[model samples]
Target: MSVDAKARYAQSHEYARLEGDLVIVGISDHAQDELGDIVFIELKEVGKKLERGQVFGTIESVKAASDLYMPLSGSIEAVNDDLQADPALVNREPYGNGWLIKVKPNNAKDMEALLEAKAYASMVGEE
Candidate 1:
């Protein structure tokens, strides 16, 4: 699997990709693969502030349901409504169209602290 080198990941499997001043967030491909086919997603409202490592949502898959964590402290600017209609997009395109949220990150340093593609892949045993 090709992980997005531009994106950073949390130990918990959430990924954050910087785009201008906002950060795009989502579950990593590894997480979705582990959970199997995603069936439902419950997300925090837009404009809600969330701390790093906070449970911002829940993802239910064929295998099991999992908590979705915030990779950085910030206010959610947008949620992917597309997922409500086609949740499997998360499994199909986790690094692209399947992204879950857009956040205005609170700290640049926090963004830097996340795992790089190589590190994250190694952590997940994909390396």
Candidate 2:
């Protein structure tokens, strides 16, 4: 998994990127690599309000199913409809076309506390 300079990460492996007034959230590339061959993902509703560290969804792989956590508090603005039909896009592009959700952030300061690429890489032992 490559580092995204503009993104921040949670210890649980979720990534968040601030884009305008919205924050894009997704599982990190390292996470997909660990999960191996993701088969399904269940995301929360678009309008649902989520708190920091809340479980908003789940990702199922051939090996195991894991909960997806919200990196910060927000109301979901959109979910990646594309993953409903082709989940492999996550494996191919976890940070791009495979992004899981977008949220209207409730607290911008929460983002500042997240791990930076270098810190996240070290947390996952990439460094």
Candidate 3:
């Protein structure tokens, strides 16, 4: 598996990647690993508004069903529908095809508040 890229991370384990006003959101490799065998994912719909740190979805695993939090405040632009059919993509390519949503940021400066990959790695005790 590829290491989590140098994207921004929320303490809740959500990751964020910015592309213009679009901020892509997903759970980190570490979070997925900890969750184990994802069976179902419930994502916020496109056009949904969300606040940073707010619970927007849920991921169910063999072990548990956990809340998915927003890494940045935004209006959901798109959601990965592929997950409704096969949640395993989150394990296969979390940073790419498995991303959860594209959000149009409501506060651009909020991106700066997320933890960097290195810092998140530290927070999760990777180093």
Model 3 regions more than 4 Å off: 1-3
Query: Ranking under lDDT, best-scoring first?
Result: 1, 2, 3
- Output the worst ten-in-a-row residue range by lDDT, candidate 2: 1-10
**lDDT (Cα, 0-100) at 38 in candidate 3:** 90
**Whole-model Cα lDDT per candidate?**
0.93, 0.93, 0.87
Q: After superposition, how far is residue 4 of candidate 1 from its true place, in Å?
A: 0.7
Candidate 3 lDDT, 19-113, residue by residue in tens? 87688899888898988899999987888998887888999999999999999888999999999999999987888888998999998889899
Output the TM-score of candidate 1. Answer: 0.97
Q: In candidate 1, how many Å is residue 73 off?
A: 0.2
TM-score of model 3 vs. true structure = 0.94
Estimate TM-scores for all models. 0.97, 0.97, 0.94
User: What are the per-residue Cα lDDT tens digits for candidate 1 across 1-127?
Assistant: 6688999999999999999999999988888888999999989999999999899899999888899999999999999999999999999999999999999988877998899999999998887
What's the best-to-worst order under TM-score? Answer: 2, 1, 3
List RMSD in Å for every model shown.
0.8, 0.7, 1.3
Tens-digit per-residue lDDT, 59-84, candidate 2: 99999999999999999999999999
Model 3 lDDT vs. the true structure? 0.87
Error of 2 at 25 (Å): 0.2
| Segments of candidate 2 deviating more than 4 angstroms | none
